[model samples]
Target: MTVKEVKKGNACALLPLIIFVALFIGAGVLTKDFSNMPLNVAVIIASAVALLMNRKEKFEIKVSIFTKGAGHPNIMLMAIIFILAGAFATVAKGMGAVDSTVNLGLSLLPANLLMVGLFAIGCFISISMGTSMGTVVALAPIGIGIASQTDIPVALTMATVIGGAMFGDNLSMISDTTIAAVRTQHTKMKDKFKVNFFIVLPGAILTAIILGVITRGNKAVIGADFHYELIKILPYIAVLAAALAGVHVLIVLIGGTIFAGGVGLADGSYSFGSFLKTIGEGLMSMEDLAIIALLIGGLVEVIRHNGGIDYLLYTVNSKIKSKKGAEFGIAGLVSAAAIATANNTISIVVTGPLAKSIADEYEIDPRKSASLLDTFAGSWQGILPYGGQMLAAAGLAAISPVSIIPYSFYPILMGGCAILAILNGYPKLGTKSKEVKQVATVPVEE
Candidate 1:
């Protein structure tokens, strides 16, 4: 199809996405139970609508488009990461790593500092690992354990993990969202990190102070008598080490899983049969996420084929009136994509090319564009009740994800800073920067 033909189909093709959103959100609102409507079901209905919209295409052609979307390299790679993460998580839990790590961290912090410490540790781990989900999974249980022993509210404790996870997610070089943004905008990761850090750091500090006050007089006794086998912690250590070495995230997760299995076997926590079983269990645990990922891939593929993304790019870019307006547009684009995808990395992937195009058209710095992508995506992911980061943390803490949204300091701060920076043009694109000319035109790369 010609570009004009593609453009003509964009709006019509995108109607299914509107339908999906309305059905899913409306259903959830009416039922007051988001889970009442299965995520995959919503995607399936959306996909059907997309199929029906392509009236001129043969069934085979439409199926081919769907296949292309489901098989995108980035989507496949994420599936691998999810599988490995599941395996590592299960093996680590079986080895008592979770308990040990929780106790270890709790014992180290002063009673009065538990709230601050949780936030700090969450941030540290996410920054180290470059994954908000990983950070929340590692720390939320500890927050729950602490809450059980202390007078602190479980929801508040959960919010600490949420806040800290977003703090690191927004600034970490290894984060998938960061990687997607930098790659898409053709900017250096270090440059983006510098901009992101300054914007989120103050909010983190203020959050620490606020949490400290709220949790005052709720000190819990952190016992030190528990025995911990250092070997059990190898999975997390290996994951962190690989991420620090700048390994690809999928490979790092797979390596961690292998390490965790070896440790589990060495500790006699699993026999060969049980080790294999653990892998199966781990894979099974990720079934929900895997399905969600595939459905989203297929659904978005339909949307892309119909021109939804192109329509967005055309409409959003054409309205840019100034540098500040362009920046706000970029932020809104990334935020909208993140809300749709519910995964920051995927959101960046979906929006990054368009953002680069807008940045180039407006003479915005690639680094600034990348920073906006990370900042906005991280902000939305952090506070979104249905987003994976909050869901993972809430699940671990046994709290409502929405309960943490209002108190998530880093996300709220990031959003505010992003808006302020855009308005003030604080990180102005350097005229001498090579990327100012290089990143103006962005096309979806297969």
Candidate 2:
């Protein structure tokens, strides 16, 4: 059977996405419990709706499209990473790594500076891992434990971690968002980083200061005799060391898992069978996220095929004229994609080509466009209650994702700074006046 092609700028093709938001957000609002409706369930429903919207095509052909999207290289890679992260986190926790790390941190940091310290840790871990979700998986539990021990609110503490996680997500050279942005705009990674760093540095410093001042009175209650086994923390150290040395995330996680199991065995923390059980359970824990990601992937592919994404691109393109407007348009594109997809890296990938076109048309520097894409995508990703970063943090902390939104100071500040950068052309090195036409004309490598 011949399949009917969707026309570009077909707004009706976006109904499935609207249906998804309505069902997901509406359920949460109606139930007054955002976690009551499982995200996978919502995504499944949305996927079905997306499938139904493709009625003009043969059923088997539609299924193929959905399957292809679900099995996209990027989606599969992310699924593997989620599985590895879960196993690593659970194995490390079983081996007492998290508690030991928390104890060591508490012993070193003053009580009043707990929030700032945790934020810094989150930043460091995310920068090393080059993934916000991995950083959240490693740090959220510790942040929760810290909150339980101190007067700091769990939401506030987790928010600090989420904020810091986003900080590194925006700036890390190895981050998927960074790679997508740089490749899409045809800019060197270092050039993008230089522009991104100066734009975000003020926000990071301001966030740290804000966290410190707010938690100044909440001193941690650490006992003088608390014992932390250094060996138990080796897994995390190894992971960080490998990640900082530019190892792939999957390798880092695999090595970390084995190291944690070895440490557990040597310390007699559990039997070999128990170690296997923990790893299995950890992988199982990520089932919901993995499933939801796949469903979202498939659904987005359907939407793209139906011209939803093209509609978005068309809408943004029609409104761009001046340099500031072009910057705002790029930011708007990525931000909208982030909100729609609930994944920053995917958002960058989806919006990158369109953004590059806008930059070329408006004489905006490729590096600045790359920075806008990464920064705005991260900014939106951090605050979205259903976004992976917030979901992971909330899941680990056993709190509502909504609860963390109010305290996501760093993401909020980063977004504000991004807007200011667009408005005032902050970095100043890549403005239209100094535009390198050759950079904008550079071919984007697929």
Candidate 3:
């Protein structure tokens, strides 16, 4: 057995992750700008720290350990999906799909339902785009516009946008977080989405009602202010529909890209040259995430090899007895990862493997674990002051991120709903894991 495969875990194995998080959040806190600390750089430093530990092993063995984790099939597939999803998204947006979809959602909104409408729109756009940041960036200005026209506070309006963005982020078929959660837990993306969507639906509805009450008597004059081409919105709808129908993700993305590019060409939205260029730009946009995944995988492998994961699991497992306790442990794990990273996608990637192991150990359904991973991470990332989603929304609205916290009804309610789901054991995907009994037989046949 290796150092990591021991009956007793080594507590010291966790130092690398601790140091990385410290550097990341510490630098962000000091600079008051989380973006100042590049995740790639911090992870690289942490990885080096991990390599320096347990130096008695041959250097080749140490390098092999990192490579083993970095080259994991799940991690490799996730990077490919990220790259493909980015390309599809870029093509769709290049064809005016995002703008048209936004315009269409807003144009249909009843003037009195502005706040709830924005929330719903945020959800739709984020779901289609598979990115909360993209949704926030696209809708923050619109939220501000609506706020200026109505009695709603910009903070509340912006919070609504953040809520909607996160809702979709937690459940979007193509979201990297969802992909990571599903891939790591070995569950189908559609299965995870279905479970995650229902789990958070109540919270979303309640949030809408709350926004409705808060925005009562307030009118948003968005009439005739935006124009949309219905045809331009087809690609998003097509991709979403196909994915939910359980089509292969790669097919959905590639087909969506081709369809969107054809539309863009026909509409003169972009030339053939521009279409190729947009694909390149999209791929580039995802490079950081892809690279980060590889580095994190390698870093985490080193940690795991040193028994950090085993120790953490041992600690969590000690207090968890029943299935409910296991679920709670998973929730706690997801939430802590989110709190540390302040990015839902990164948090999911950071905790995915560990969550899977916990699920297997407890025989908890992988789907439930996946849902918790996405939902909890989404819930926490939105309300955090230093999170990119909140920071981006605040920056666009020219308001304090702190002000947005009071009105972040969706994510707060989301966390509550997730807890309730655990308490009730919703979905009841009865434990599918069982211990294998090795049957021994003498060589009687010989």
State which candidate, 1 or 3, has the greater TM-score.
3
Tens-place lDDT per residue, model 2, 1-446, is 00112134678877877776676567767896455666567778878888887577987887888898777665565566667777877788788876676556656767678888888877765664456887788778778778888878999988998998898888765466776676667666556777888999889999999998988888566455546998887777777566646565567778888989999999899799999999999888767666766676788788878877667656665675578998898888788878766778767765675687677767788878989999999999999887878888887888899999999999999999989998887888833323222222233222
How should the candidates be ordered by TM-score, best one leading?
Answer: 3, 1, 2
Give me the runs in candidate 1 sitting further than 4 Å from their true place: 1-9, 125-151, 168-199, 213-220, 223-227, 337-371, 384-406, 421-446
The estimated TM-scores of all candidates read: 0.78, 0.72, 0.94
The number of clashing residue pairs in model 2 is 1
Q: On residues 323-377, what C-alpha lDDT tens digit does candidate 1 reach at each position? A: 7888899989888867765667667765676677677777788878888898888
Candidate 1: residue pairs that collide: none
Error of 1 at 295 (Å): 3.8
Residues 1-446 of candidate 3: C-alpha lDDT, one tens digit per residue: 32124355789999999998998889988998888889889989999989889978987898899988887766777788899999998888878898998998898899888888899999999998899998998999999988787778899989999999999888888888888888777777777777788899999999999999977887557756788998998988898999999888878888988999999999999899999999999988999999899999999999988889888887877787887898898888879878987878888898888887778777777788989998999999989988999999999999999999999999999999999999998866554422222123311100
Give stretches of model 2 more than 4 Å off: 1-7, 111-115, 121-199, 213-224, 322-327, 333-408, 421-446
Candidate 2, position 35, lDDT = 57
lDDT at residue 432 of model 1 (Cα atoms): 29
